[model samples]
Target: MRAGHLLLSRSSLSHLLLIFTLLSTFTAASFVRSRAPSPQRTAGAASRRDLISDTVENILHPVIHFAPTVLGISINNKGLQLDNGTNPNDPVQVSQALQTQPPPIDLGQLLQDITPNYNTSKTLDSACSAIHTALPNNDYVGRVCTTPECIQSTTHYYNARQAGNRPACVTYPTSSQDVVTIMKLLREYDVTYAIKAVGHSTGYNFTTALGFSSTTGILIDMSKMKAVSYDASTGIARWEPGQSWGELATTMAQYGAQVVGGRLGAVGPGLSFGGGISWYSGQVGFASDTTHAFEIVLADGTFIIATQDNQYSDLWWAAKVGMNSFGIITAVHSRTLPGTTTYGGSVIFPTDKMLDVLGAYANWINGGADKCKKGFVLPAITDFFVESLITRLNIFEFFFDGTDPGECFKDFNIINTLYDDRKVQPYPDFLNKALTNQQFVFSGFNNALYSSVTDLINKDQLLAIYNAWEEYSVQTSGAYLQNTLSFSVITKTGLAASQANGGNAMGVSGGDGYLWVCYAEGSIPAIGALMDTKLFGLTPQAAQAVPKSQRKLPLYANYARLEQKPFLTYGGIELLRQIKKKYDPDNFISSHTTGHDFY
Candidate 1:
């Protein structure tokens, strides 16, 4: 683009808005097939034809920020294409003599000529065919699997989008080099592919294969890549993306070190990249903050070691905190700290105690700096299960970093409880529990939840939100399966700890503690879509109940709806653009994957 580029006409603006609205609803029609490019870009530079193609590209593929559409010119099987000129893959220029007259080389066989090993055409077949075809030839066929044994290995991600859907074929990579080979194959064939770690992610495309029908993309499962090692002298732990926090904790217990990570036994690398929130956050910080570097494979089948100081440092920092983008991380060398026994446990209370419990939680978070700082601490996590529209159970899943329950649990001790399970446990033993409320929301239930800043919320406001959840759950319980509401506290201790050891990218202001209000709905497939609409809607309504002066809601991307734009709240779109430009200059991969928008 020059001093001035062609501004999108009012007519084009109208078209974009229409497309956005249509895409807002989950309909196949909204995802139009990308059209093929023209036979040749015979026009000269900055010609009227070039500008038209550039303008159309901006409208069709909108990013957080669209740089001047370079030229979408390429020489693929179709010929000298020039539809999306700014496409980084496009050739900069062709010899002047060649552009004037087309060569006699057969266009039909041209694609294979460039990449002879790949499929000559985008063959219309299940992704299984591609996987089967590549198996015997690639060196990784021993790890390549179409057998039930291999597929059965990843049955744990209970969400339907993850567990129910299966990939056409699963390729297990044992190392970063294996991933590079897989990436090259996928790119050569132009096949849609997805990368899976510990199957806990929620999206259909993220954990399974992609397809126009179903089961199309070849899945790269990272389970076998669970190679873990550590350099005690350097305090750096090399963890394959597939390793779980629980597994790592047990391993580190032997070494007297711990890697900050998700509290659950199954939470894996994907969440690690999405700002891993852990119980230890109050004592240390976010899991991502301890990430020393990343071994990543870029979209173009290139490998780079990204560190805070590496040439690809921008990509490293971006992947650490942001949603999936730019590349697939193979392994993360994370920093570790001394491991020790921690104390805390669960207490049970009736639903009626919510008001009192929330008030106490608010007070606990509002308490002074020393109690909430990066030292000995106790953080509270609650799971309020809606046993019925009329009855609720409050379970306090609180913890302290030391071997004894200190005064931090004082606010909660006063509340009468039906049972007490608090006790001191080794770090590895405590990390085994994954605190999801499974008693109410089962494996089969389709669920979604939202989190809002709790500092502005009080006990009365929380009770109102609970009331809304109860009402919705009651109305839908008859038609659907069930629904529930829960609360988790991220005290100032955790907030301040997130800023420790180089800080993390959770996108929160440092040094202040707040409550995270969480609501979950579980239902049958028929009403799952409806539940999603309602669940996403009620989040803001819950926030609005807070006084206008105090209302500042930043939805956690980890818990947000698919359509929700959470990246913007993390920081700014401007920074997102600068990094994307440096990393994925060629707009090849981002569009095919799931995550929030680039922002």
Candidate 2:
């Protein structure tokens, strides 16, 4: 994490800048955190102060001194190198360093191993050949990886799929026209393909292989299609598929226009098309709720504009959380408003207050009057338990239009007061780097388990879940309960709009506010069963009286395991099937039928 620097006081800001410069002038703590052996997982494995101190001493300090003399490179606390002067030899040195460490995993090698033999099927062969012919000669899509690597590398799916298998080939679509062309290829070849934007699926559900399709068939990558156009006079934005929430925020900020997007900007626009939720979602509506129109490429290789006024409005409803069962979404036109400069940052709270903290969070989401208008949506989250000693409560707090820190102080103080030991830092600085700089055991993929309780916002339920999480993690050692809490006045919009297309299983009707409590943690084999059993497979049950109908479906695509029937959970099982038949009768996109079938 970047030093706890904010645009707060002059001294603090200056110290932050000085520290930033000093750290930059040196090149010591490589983003590698060294992990000590753990006996069993435990909460007291590493204290926050200890971790912070070690990060400064081991990583930051060395890079600070060694940088100018040996490497002649200046790196910021976040490890972004600043070039004082150009050195052609620097490329060779940097290349050697990267080669020594390499990225965590190789995407091509993993694909070749996990992919079925090249002789798998005619459909796969035909689809792969077509994809290979489509790519322009570029290192990004070199001769080795036909289509899969292009998607995997750019989308960072290799990072996500390490917990599972990687796709063999990835296909790039230059535009909505290209998307339709690829769909026709899939239909003619009778091959299955995965339609992905952002590729930030959370769990095993969305990314997992559902049908009998080989890896080489198709991995439809839309990263290149990221284009954003806005008409300030029209108060609307036409956003292309592969765009991320961060890109949207930065882009819109330039025009002083804002759309409801999430803190994790890298998690593409595909997420919003599937029922977008954001910190601002509570007041404005889920990201999808703000969507006015969608330019879609359906299974029949036909491109159509679908909206409330469009001819295919039924298909529009099903697209909310239908996964890829429908077709590819090329662009989304969403209502936009003036952007705000004033924003809130990520907050850290003491570990002892997890239950009370989350309970208070549940209460706040249910009753934080006028906060959403100012863009205050706090998604409570817990980050890595870096050695069983420290797990930071990472909260994504937002403010929409208000710039006065004084205006946001009440909310900030309320949350900070929850714990005597709290650290407040700007959101941008916090997310610009990894959690620790030690030789930490970095997992190939980070998985987040999430469930939303909308109608029944019970304090006891929140507390019970927290207590259960603590008890569970205490035994497991490596795992901890992380949460992201969002409550919105737009609950009615989500409920009404979810059924507008074809409806979904994300039971979010008549909810006062939405509470999405998620548990996100990462670990290596040294932690063993603690990472798998306690972290991976524990079902959280807080209130037995509450039915499952009140919960919003899980948000990120990868977080939902295949059996979760995510399409149904987000809206409804039956509606998903109907939309599947209507838009993609051939099921070109994945239809995860482990147990829950769309139709």
Candidate 3:
């Protein structure tokens, strides 16, 4: 009985200790809670707790929970009252009692991120109704086939913006008046918009459609506005925006005329703003250099004409490389060359003499030996099958205006025959047989990284650079090295025509530089993965292969990657910023906020 009494006493002491611990915890919690407001008051305590819970919820589910302006919010359970520590009147806050709240999301920022696509069925229905009401009798106004089979007839390319998760829509403008109507609607809705011409741009800012992903915003399809013509007397041609280089080429060929345009035929004018290097660039200059005039539709739904001698010269300069940020170009007037029905083409070389062959060509180009100014000379090195397979290096060349092939061929033969292993075939038969099967050679625009050099490096320097490039090419999949190693005389024809009327942002500010173009060609597989170093599975990955000194931080506008340094590369970001302010102060007109667009 005495032992049992002692056990019972010990149990009572243990229970007392447990109660004491619970009381201490509750007292400490209450003291801390009381410091925020009158936490002793049950209503105040509940309100502070509610504020903390709401703050967390807002962060997690902002779209459904909060209004548009909220940027971000963080809640500190330590102090519940509008902690006077940060800015007050932040609308994102849950209560005046809380110390801090989320900052509001910028309206401009939201517009930049959001790209939405309208349901094709819904947009078609909307288009049909609008077209009928506007122009009842005109068959062309709403002429899209309305049959069940023709349901998804409109071309849609709104994928990238949708992936980034933005509001996007599409409007079909059947006429110039319809374009004005859409402009009015954009103003009324107070939303950002962009125009689409052939949907060719790969960059986030220029293109709206993603082939397999969700679309971001309203696409302004200008396919219906295709118009082209040429005047032989004045050597002038007018082209609408939506036409492809191939289409324009064929059309102009009928008029016995040719254009100095992009190298590939399929490239469109949408983001090939200003102009770009083309196959004919060797002779005439760049595509934009030949542009005589432009008809631009401004932000205010007004049309303005810019020509060689014009009141809106600044617009003309901006139009060359300004992209779609300023306005939509309805038509371009460009200088056209007298058509040549016959042209010279051939491949020159022998595999064993690659070093000598390349060196000879380089010397000729550098020394102006053959007077081959603005002439296209593309070289390719590939495997040749003989008794044993060996490397074959050769050049594919063409002279557009029917220059006598004898002199050029003699020059080529002089170096080639020295090695006693060279052969030459006529231009006509060679191109037909060699290039016949490779029809899709110019189908897509590959990512091309380039650098320019005016200070001619020595043969040793050239050999060193080539060795480094060849090593890089072998290491990386699908990388290629090609060069346009010519002189300034070739590009001197147009005489910096655009410079007289302001100047193109992309036009050569510093003239005469050697252009080295390195490109990666293949199907789009794992672009993001390729960029990330971790995926490469190496101690030093692809990024390390390209040194800071080797890399030209600036990029050529036409072939540049969207993620590449825009301001430093493009050389017009600040100028564009000031222009954006003057033309679009409210920032309602949004492109994908490129590095150039940011500053």
Candidate 4:
């Protein structure tokens, strides 16, 4: 502890001082908006803004009490006050905020957090023991399965390559309170952990992993909290983080309604928060747009609700695509719509017409995309590749909430096909068919490179992406198994749908770009993982071909490779960092959790 600076060995005093200044001054909205002003101040005007509010008084009150540690403080009639003569409860004075080249801090003392370096087993034991004793009844699901096969099974993800990294323990919470208890213990112990909601995430350390020093020590599987309830009057549906789209779709069908959810049945909330792309996305926008409320647990174990109209509205917009930075969401409440039946199915084209299909697919999204009736309700569409031991086929999965096979979809009729199963069926049945054989038989370690691009490139560019995938598929034909490169448009209509719901972390706007989904599938023991990354055309040289303005953020977090930091691609990564600090002051999240290092 030092009197004139924040002296801690972990970081420099100046940097720490600067950080504290930003954390105590800037609002969460400042960092995330695409056109937001920079934090740097000019000498002329001392414009100021308040970052804290009475709602979060409990969090910042201690900071005020400890102001003397870095900014200096003194006792006064109103209580503990800053030495700078500012009101402790008044809005922070930005005019007195830190400058670009901040001077040495003058304080009476320093406060430091517990170091992240600790014995992994001891911390894990402590966390698990506390959770076990606290939730001793049917609500808790905590275990340390020693069997190799069982440990191996828990690691299985949509992509099989991510299956081998197991953590020391797995704990499932039955309710938000359980999450609050578990988070408190883990944060207290400074334990690194991963979160798994059905293991659909392909990114490493996202769900669970083993090395404590390297990122994984504990895995918090959110499976036991599967509860879904719908209110007919309000037309709102609430679901636990663990529930899958398949389960929700089927259940909501009984109520003659449906929530904007995953296209493939197995996807859970992680994708929803990461700008969830769906078969219904064209009209409904991202499934995440449907999210109206989130019951979340902050790093400090404080359970709070983040919504558009609340005091935490900034956090609400940030959480839209900020992933786990804001908190661990326990329940997501979204409005449901009437009419769940849809007409469409898979149409398989011969391998000879691959080029034709790719070209036509490009045309469908580029020129004919406007055929969307309401501009928002798009004819559900997906074209992908299915490859197995001896078979390779191109399939187009289509659907629409309406009865007719709309003209917007008639473009597919141009190509000769083998099996065409387009028909009118319930939404649940449509997604059930999406749970195809490939997911079961040949699924393993895989990576998806998704992005929002300026527009659909030429057939040649699209072919290049596919050709690269094909080459990799041929090379690692045995290890990774199958891969497909597909594209989905985020048309003007879809963009509005998302914007109407408080927007999200994705900086994309209508007319800005098309969402590209490039995925590679294979069995365990990945031979194509590296090549899977290369197929995206996200490399520096590849991105250079596009105009600077059109160079969109690379891969979606859910579909990104292990090394990718999708949060940085967001326009508000800095705002997300400030929000992280406000909620996770002790740096517990960066030390103990995986995915997107906000700072």
Candidate 5:
């Protein structure tokens, strides 16, 4: 069970060698290997020559001859010796032979020596083999993919940047027990890993394994755990993490109820953990605020239920916007609302109407639209250029909990639009429409996103931010495939609802309304780095354009880029840190897993 004491059997050796060959071939040509030393190996650095010699010595010390019997050769810690008439202890003869003969190679040590910071191929293979052996009869056992084709087949991600990461194995766990088993083995082997729910995350390494030695990583794909159930008596809806919000909505509609969830159908339950925004947020709160409980497996393989009033209540609060820093979530239980038909749809205006659209959005929020607590709107300015043809659009998506929004959306409705598809529709249908229309544009391109919150600004402030964004977009147009700046409001009523339902760790107060701004971009692989570098400055630039009085708000975790520190802006950092320490005392999850870091 220990990594250092691992001894491979003949069958295991063959498996290890096959994995080694595959990984070496896969990475040698396509990926750049990381040479960083592991935490344990960083302290007393050895010279390259000495490290190579020591590796050879370790390999040859545990001599494994192909034949059943040794051929008059004796290997030991000192050196290799030949027992052919010459004295076996003769130093000169042994030294000469050591210089001439090729030393035996220990596949395990060789792998370790090369991959100091990652689990060796032997260790990874052993872990995978153990998983297959432990869960032989489980349906998901067949889904433990190791070959390139199988890994590729199961490795689809919404962001192309994440798709490029190749884990040594991809595991599909159907239940908490399966996840517990995998977590135990991964910890035992000290392997780095990433978890995938729907893979809708934009940040690199957020849902996929990355780095030069990422071939040794493991990806725990939770897609097979899609199971949903409803309790009509209590109006509670329970589901596994594998399903999407769209699927959950459709299924819950059959029960005449719906859970607060993401607006996009393809986005999974992971959104709730990042403080999900939804069409219903204006009436209820964040999607996370509706969570009744969570069934999660900790880094030490302990499976427990986290609820607002349970022994793990702190974990419940942290999990709301924790962003995968605590553990792997298996299941979620949420409060359900009546599944009533809602009025919502998208309206697209021409580029020339940008000011009008901005003014409408500003007026709606600043003019007490949040007071209605039944309407939600997302306004975005998008610029798309293809084949040297540029197109600019002002798109607004409006929603209401009931059939009529009344004067809530009057300003937006009066704008002259290029395309208007507003209508009364079912909640699930509206989500499906948005998904079909919006998710297809950046299908194959690498993407990056940044998020910030500000006080509901006036028309002039919105215009200034828009102008800055437009200038940045035009300056970097040739570097990207598409760019968009979108805004969503977090109403005071919504924040009150969140506080009523066990306040989360997002650090927002109900004193006033605020706006969530998201800047997203997509580019080809060759320009992904350039796009990210430029995109990093966009949020700060826009913040500077607005007055300081209106810009000191928390960043939304779900929409934030990798480098942005949403946790730093949170008001409950000390409590969050204590909860993290109590739950993950050794910091194993944060150290071994790739996710948004809290510290």
Candidate 6:
């Protein structure tokens, strides 16, 4: 996110600038370690030591050198020219060179050579020790743990697949200043790190560090930062990154208010960064759209507040759906609505009624369902594996902003159901119940979600898509413990609400209705790869069933697979890239952390 000036001392600024210059100027090929003896230097040629010294001097001073050309472009009276005599100023040639070029100089080697007593081969234990030394005598030290018990508690992910990662240490920061201190130390020591809020993300490396060679890795646990408050005068709600939807909803209910948040209770505030969809989305838009401001810690360890009409407004726009590419979000302030009584609960039907359920859902949405802005529905064909056999069930979740849904869900009401639990209840109570039920059924399984988006489909298209997913699931039943195919309608009212409130990065419009189709699976580690590969293949086949015009819709980032490039479909790639470059010119976040790839 955008910020004011970097918060670094003069000496640190100079050191960082020197490092940045060296990294930008040289390629890895220039510093490759060789076992062969050095060649004899010709008369008047400089030695390797002399070359390095001269390079450092030239970087510090703003003097241009012609001897050592970069990217085959040399500064002269004739201007920039490539080795092949092509114009280096041409965007096409420059882009081609960037694509074909090798990686930049190694930071570890560069730091070791440039900084006094800086070790390039630091271990996780040593790094944690260093952090402890830096923050000694502070309460934060107690939160920084390297013990197995602490790590296990900090790395408790909703998806079992993510729980296998063992970082060098886990540090829980309870305030923005605490995060700033930890972030500064991590950057100073050149440690790779990942930020974890509630650990609901299913993508590999999305909330954990994958691998660390010579350097160490750390997990910044935000769970201890759980805090929530609401303002009665402004109708605004403020929550820390660690607060879950259920917690936030329950807290807001005390104030007779609510903010658009995750549908599930366990999801953290991080959901807003991925364009969160909530029961209130039909009326207020995505959770990201409801956000009024973000308290962020930039890559350089500087804190800034981003809002719709502020100096950091660009960051405000991008952070809405930019994921974790920008910086760490410490707190979110959002617009709130009155906490009205809600009508919502799950309805379960036997597998035999799948077609009837699908038909009714399609008919409801097609027949002016968008006009009922206060209503939302999600229908899923869920399967449970028990005793070597699978049992399939049709589960439909419905919600209305008020006490009743009126005629909004009449089509689905007529279908015979094996079980029905629809009722009028307080919003917070419904969310807590849903989360309790989900955890009882799906906890402890290695889970992931694969998703795609397309125009709202007809009965035949829905049936075709369901059959394709069901065939694949049955064929690979041995690979997974549970499989579910679910759909969320993105109505015209939702799109309009998003625009009415300052728009987000997801480039959807109210031209036509759409559905975010997701395939969620729970499996063992032994077959996770096979399940992912086969499930990924369903995207193209599902897209083919929809009209060609609506085949390239933006995939929902919250439910997307690691392989899916949701950002590319946002229709604002160039703007996003520019914002990234503006805020993170050194590429510090992308280099030192792992998550969804935005560049």
Full-model lDDT for every candidate: 0.52, 0.47, 0.41, 0.55, 0.66, 0.65
Worst 10 residues of 2 by lDDT: 432-441
Return the candidate ranking by lDDT, descending: 5, 6, 4, 1, 2, 3
Worst 10 residues of 3 by lDDT: 383-392
Error of 3 at 506 (Å): 2.9
- Kindly report which residue stretches of model 2 are placed more than 4 angstroms away from their true locations once superposed: 1-119, 132-143, 146-155, 162-168, 203-216, 353-356, 369-373, 379-383, 394-400, 404-443, 452-454, 479-507, 525-533, 542-559, 570-576, 591-599
- Candidates 3 and 6, the one with greater lDDT: 6
The local lDDT score (0 to 100) that residue 382 gets in candidate 1 is 25
Best model per TM-score: 5
Q: Give TM per candidate.
A: 0.70, 0.68, 0.59, 0.71, 0.77, 0.76
Tens-place lDDT per residue, model 1, 1-599, is 11012123334543553443232222111111221221221211121112123445445444311211121212111212223332312211121212232322221111111111211123313333555554443322221233454534333343433443333356667777777776766666666556667655544332222211112345677777777788999989888877777777887778787777776665667777877666666665566877889888888879899888868767766776665676778888988877657775546554456567767766655563237443222222222111111122344566666675556667777987765666788876765642232232233334455666545455677666666655554333322333446555555656565565545444566645555666665443323455566666767776666776664445566666556566665644566667877777865566655556664
Candidate 1 residue spans exceeding 4 A from truth: 1-146, 153-156, 163-166, 204-215, 368-391, 434-442, 454-456, 478-482, 491-493, 500-506, 548-553
After superposition on all CA atoms, how large is the RMSD of candidate 2?
13.2
Q: What is the lDDT of residue 159 in candidate 3?
A: 19
Backbone clashes under 3 angstroms, per model: 8, 54, 42, 11, 0, 0
Winner on TM-score (1 vs 3): 1
Candidate 5: segments with Cα more than 4 A from true spot:
1-120, 137-154, 205-216, 435-441
Q: How close is candidate 1 to the true structure, as a TM-score?
A: 0.70
Q: Stretches of candidate 4 above 4 Å error? A: 1-120, 138-153, 205-216, 373-390, 435-454, 526-549
lDDT of 4 by residue, 1-599 (tens): 12112224535654665455333322121211111221221111222322234456446454533443454422111211133653222212211221111212211112111112122365666676676687675222223234443343344455443444434456667899988988887877777777777556655543343221122356677777788899999998888878678888898898899988776776667878777877667666778787778889988899999888898877777777766666788998887878887876766666567778778776666655545532221221112121112134455677676677567666667888756777888988887664232232223334344443334466666665555445444433323223454456666667777777666776666564464544545321212334344444444333343456665654566666544566777666777777778877877876676666554
